[model samples]
Target: MLQLGGYFKLIELGLEDCVSDIDAQPVYGYALYKDGKGAKLFYPLEKFNSDVSGRSFHNGRFIQKMREKAVTLPNVRLEQGTVTSLVEEKGTVKGVQYKTKSGEEKFPMALWQY
Candidate 1:
């Protein structure tokens, strides 16, 4: 899928596979998935006192640098969901039931045919 300006591979969709042609973030947010664990894109919100000094507390300078260079994160959406069930018909993999922000919606989804 494409996002912002880059793209990322949707290795899997929950447990039921779903491939998309739309820009990733155009559909969802950002996060990371590995080893069956889910991680969200969030950095710590630091606090500073008026007496504090040294490096700037907000180190968003890195993000600023990337923006300056026109470099950006890949287009990937947070698959914020879990597979509830599989829709099968006559032993054929038909569709999937997944939970999104819109609750569970089982639409006819097939990659090869999509």
Candidate 2:
């Protein structure tokens, strides 16, 4: 898990520091049931040891943290808008057209290149 986190630069971004016991919890496993019967299956995280574990977190907070970190980087723009359409060229997506409070805007894919 540490190696995977490192690959995504989570360590460099100090994302681990954002984890709090209040929002992040350890989830050992889950049970599913149907028709008021006992759990049909018991899925444990430890069984898939190398892939993922029993860890739970608040998605909203995690996304907020990512957005906060993203906006701090050069050439990064965080806009509050709804994507209206895709800008396609030669059968490929080139950019996006979005609507904001004031007006509509076009964000080309080229602008995303760093």
Candidate 3:
């Protein structure tokens, strides 16, 4: 289910937990998941950023630099519910229904359908 899909984000990418060089961005912490597993958070990839001083993302040192500091995350979930029905008004879909850990809820929306 870990398909790396393309999407969009509208905010700044924050720093993550890593032991990078002084010039590199250092990771400050970790993220734990529900299964007692964890992974290092990193600065969201900036396609334009680079370290021309080094091997340009080819260096293997970065691998060991991370494994040496492996972390653990537990009790993590992305969302509480699956998107339920898409409500329709006239020809436009205008709402969404969902059930969370607590119960059900609805969110009204402007619609777009193919």
TM-scores of all candidate predictions against the true structure: 0.24, 0.52, 0.24
Arrange candidates by lDDT, descending: 2, 3, 1
Clashing pairs in model 2, backbone N/Cα/C closer than 3 A: none
Q: Which of candidates 1 and 2 is the stronger one according to TM-score?
A: 2
Q: Which stretches of candidate 1 lie over 4 Å from their true place?
A: 1-80, 101-112
Give the distance in Å from residue 56's predicted Cα in candidate 3 to where it truly belongs. Answer: 15
Q: lDDT tens string, model 3, 27-100?
A: 32346577887677544445634421111232355455444444332432234366677877797667666667
Which candidate number maximizes lDDT?
2
lDDT of 2 at 86: 81
Residue 29 lDDT in candidate 2: 47
Which of candidates 2 and 3 is the stronger one according to TM-score?
Answer: 2
- Residue 15 of model 3 has an lDDT of 18
Q: Tell me how far the alpha carbon of residue 60 in candidate 3 is from the true structure, in angstroms, after superposition.
A: 25
Write one digit per residue (lDDT tens) for candidate 1, span 39-85: 88633224522312212212254344434333333642234455677
For each candidate, C-alpha RMSD in Å?
A: 17.7, 6.2, 16.5
